[model samples]
Target: MSDIVLLNKHQKKALVIELYNQGKTRRQIAETVHMSFKDMADIINEYTGEDKQVNKPEKSKDSRAFELFLQGKQSVEVAIELDMPADKVEELHVQYWRLSKLDNLEILYHEAEYSLSLLLRLHNILKDKRITKDKDISDLIELANWFTRS
Candidate 1:
């Protein structure tokens, strides 16, 4: 099995352009990146500044359903529009919601890591100061404890 590469929007666009430049067909690149052909073409056009006609393929039903849901369409409405089961529309909505939550959590995790590094640097800078003796830095200790417990 091939390992999945997780990329943010900018990175994904860059990758798509790079792959396209390397002579990969749009269909090939789209399938490789798991993006709709229309979306891939749009990215390429945005990057290259060419008014390319986007191929409106019918293969991105899940994405279309999710797009409708995000546009304030209910599950039943999306199902009717997409000619899919309401349950399937609901399932796709839930899946997209979970993925978004995971993305947010990943961002929070990176922020927490950055904060810890900053805290450590600050602690090192203040290590030689007599202020450490006056102030217990109890919050830092508590943070360390929490990390260890987790």
Candidate 2:
């Protein structure tokens, strides 16, 4: 019998990648990580290939939204510029830009940006570790909470 360890998202991904490289079965890795078989299969499917359709979102939409946000445009301005509704822009802002429960809205954006960079670093590292799937979502949330704490 193996011990069940509560891993953060980064750690889970790292473990998966390492196990994959060692030629472990997805089922075995799932068992080791205390995940469901279905989740293990999904993770293997997502991270194991270069031409993975599940991995890529539309580039232009992501890039344009990011670019507009970076240019210091207000969500309303962004909406007009991008020909999207203001409400939709607001949705994007809330989704992509973190909204703080305390302090000014602008500060929240800056904080979110910094935190996002940290998450991105972890994400890339995990990618190198070859983690796939949204299976380890709990761990990911845990990691994100850790990011906020730090």
Candidate 3:
């Protein structure tokens, strides 16, 4: 617990990868990493050579969207550039962000980019323990309050 609490983002990912390599179940790894099980499963699936995205008719569009996302383009920008529907691009954006492992970093960037203390608080939340779905929502709501108040 103390070990994980002190680890930075890359260390956490490396730990998750290490756990996966050692044949830990997705649920086990997620608990160890304090991440949501679904997010953990997605990371594991991608790491284990399973295609997270499949059977979409717009395969090339997804690929292009991934490229655009990698270039740091937001979803709206990608949608416009690719002439894609907003809803579809929105879905793709979530997938892309998860696939790219930009989860907490993106949130931190948008929510507290200039505030080291806020960033640390967000970091502490993930670092401390596995958060349940409802608890996660509560923490996010609290964080949003902090953002809005500033």
Candidate 4:
């Protein structure tokens, strides 16, 4: 492959990030972008985070979530249609975005859905005469505080 002579450092950095996100190996990126291994390593370290370097292995496109995503369905729809747990749907959502490079993160939908579900559950438990014990109340408190900012 020919060396990229006209590319600036900024352009090289962007290329590195794009290649990294596409699951290219360090050597492949360096060679493609015409950088020495040291230059490539420094760019990867300085311009990117550990999370950027991580890529889930590609799965077949036959997944229901994949089909839904291709059809432009949002997270809440995908979750409901598949009847999956929030965490699994979120995981698939993350993977889908990484591969597709689309800015389609539906965080608010998860938060609203989860919050409403939790609230309804809490309301049911509060009205239950069986939850008269302090332990159950403590568990409820813990559940209410499940997702606080660290």
Candidate 5:
């Protein structure tokens, strides 16, 4: 097998700029440029100065809610675990549940029709319930279901 030809730092920097402009992520650019992800990151940092700033990862309330949901826990459990509002937990759970279903299902065209009916039903129910409830949870659930169906 032949040895891999690596680009110099200047070339890497130029490539990183091009890739960033094209909306490719640091990791993706690193792979495409045939460099170690860390090396590519360093070059990008030198060029863009984006790495100098420290940023915290946005902790996902949805992930925590999903874990609780899998363990047979509900909104209250999620709220307690994540120290968020019960309503927020419900929102996250609905979102996570919908995404999970979409990821697992190998949906066909026919299922889309069935899914639309389900979404419309949820939408109407939520619309009606909105009159009585301050927090209309049906809307959240309906949106989630709609995305999954699509």
Candidate 6:
């Protein structure tokens, strides 16, 4: 695991400007810098002198809702845990789902890679043991061969 770097307020502002100049969307910049969406909007508003009123709950609250949701807790349970309204918990869960879509894709990619590696290892073991007579092992070997093919 990589070390987590904490950014000061000034550093965050500078990074926000740099990312914005690099054509990153506000949401992207916020996620990249571990900032809240509301804070990112405020920074953009400050830089561009646009007074856009974004009404979002605190980042901690939103994160708590998301954490519970990811843990398989229902919205009502999360609300009870966080002492908030169930509707609000549901709304935060939806936002968390949207925000984590890219992360989920990366997870799926890694899972597929792991599964392929396991299949290849199993195929090699079965072939070495001369167990290809089994229909399931033969099918698995074929599938592994298909995967290894360009």
How many clashes in each structure?
Answer: 0, 1, 0, 0, 0, 0
Q: List the residue pairs that clash in candidate 2.
A: 17-129
Give me the runs in candidate 1 sitting further than 4 Å from their true place.
Answer: 52-150
Mark the 10 consecutive residues where model 6 has the least summed lDDT: 102-111
lDDT of each: 0.78, 0.72, 0.80, 0.76, 0.71, 0.79
Candidate number of the best lDDT: 3
TM-score of each: 0.32, 0.29, 0.33, 0.29, 0.29, 0.33
> Which digits, one per residue and each the tens of the lDDT, describe model 2 over residues 76-117?
777777888776776677655553233355465467765877
Q: Write the per-residue lDDT of candidate 5 for residues 30-136, one digit (tens) a residue.
A: 78787887777777677766755566576576666687788888677678878998667756665666676853332432366468677677669867766346445
lDDT score for residue 134 of model 4: 86
Which stretches of model 6 miss by more than 4 angstroms?
A: 53-150
Give the per-residue lDDT of model 4 (tens digit) for 1-150.
975378888998899889988999998998899888877877777765544345666544338797898799988888898888877877887777767765344444355665867766766877775775789889967876885633
* 1-150: candidate 3 lDDT, tens digit per residue: 354356677787788889999989877888788888777777677787888566446659889999999999988899899999998997788777778897976565557657968767766886676654777869878998999999
**What TM-score would candidate 4 get against the native?**
0.29
- Candidate 4 deviates by what RMSD? 17.0
Tens digit of per-residue lDDT, candidate 1, span 1-150: 878778888888888999999999998898888888888988988888885544555659998886886788887888889999866875787676666675664454457765867767776876865338534677667778999999
Superposition TM-score, candidate 3 onto the true structure = 0.33
Model 6 clash pairs?
none
Task: Give the clashing pairs for model 3.
Answer: none
Residue 15 deviation, candidate 5, in Å? 0.9
Tens digit of per-residue lDDT, candidate 6, span 1-150 = 879888899999989989998999877898899889888878878998885644464568777788887888987888888999876875676676668785664454457755867767866998898877779676876998999995
